[model samples]
Target: MTEKDPRYRRAASAVKRCVAGEVFLVPVAAGVADVMSLYVLNPTAEVIWDLLDEPRSLNEICEHIQQVTGEAGGHVREDCSNFLTQMERMGLVERA
Candidate 1:
């Protein structure tokens, strides 16, 4: 990857928890039952979140997802981009 490639890291303040088959991101200061700051992740979003455990470029993230899902189209790229945008807005992830 090039040096200019965008890399993303999960926010330290956003803790991830998987409960009853659903993935949730709750703020560190927020109670587990708090719904206000809680973010529920869909399956694709959960996959994207899992991939962001470490810093990774958008290209790499989409490529990995595509490989696993066997999707050879632009949808993976769009989905990853949108998910990252939402994560950033929610303070669940950051550009690294």
Candidate 2:
């Protein structure tokens, strides 16, 4: 993926599961993400997490969110981008 327009995928070292009604990402034992701590995904993050089941460009992700939520395109795009950046920083996702 190019630096300017990256595609994202869920990190191999991380595993996602639902506990009660909340979704969480936990690091596989002895995995890179183990040191990063368990992450409890918010609803927005959960949706993005599910979409990243397969590698996807940011625009594709935003489009899906917009379709599901019927929100303004520009706003949803911006928010989704920011959310992705945060997820990457936390070692939950990586460029594909």
Candidate 3:
């Protein structure tokens, strides 16, 4: 993933949950639609979200995924990268 805009930040009102093992997210601002969107995150995405409290570089996230998987996560690197790109575009995550 490339560097993101410094001005972008996660809205504190966002809500997320893992239901039936799939992740769901909703932007919880007033006047926003109540309908939540389901995001079927791959294992790599799951790892990335699990570490959201800390700002991590793309390489750092990939390493964490590899550690959890007991092997290099190159197979899912593109998938993870794409997921982050989408999340950034959606304002689901922000650069620190």
**TM-score of every model versus the real structure:** 0.84, 0.84, 0.68
Off by over 4 Å in 3: 1-13, 31-33
Alpha carbon deviation, residue 14, candidate 3 (Å):
2.6
Count: clashes, candidate 3: 0
Candidate 3 has its poorest 10 consecutive residues by lDDT at 2-11
Task: State the lDDT of candidate 3 residue by residue for 1-96, as single tens digits.
Answer: 444422223445456677787776666667563465545566666667766656777666767777787775766567667777788877777777
lDDT of 2 at 59: 85
Span of 10 residues, lowest total lDDT, candidate 1 = 27-36
Error of 3 at 2 (Å): 9.8
Model 2, residue 20: distance off in Å is 1.4
The global C-alpha lDDT for each of the candidates, from Candidate 1 onward, is 0.83, 0.85, 0.64
| lDDT of candidate 1 over 1-59, digit per residue (tens) | 56657899898778778889888988765544445788888877888888888999999
TM-score ranking from best candidate downward? 2, 1, 3
What TM-score does structure 2 among the candidates reach?
0.84
Shift of residue 56 alpha carbon in model 1, Å: 0.1
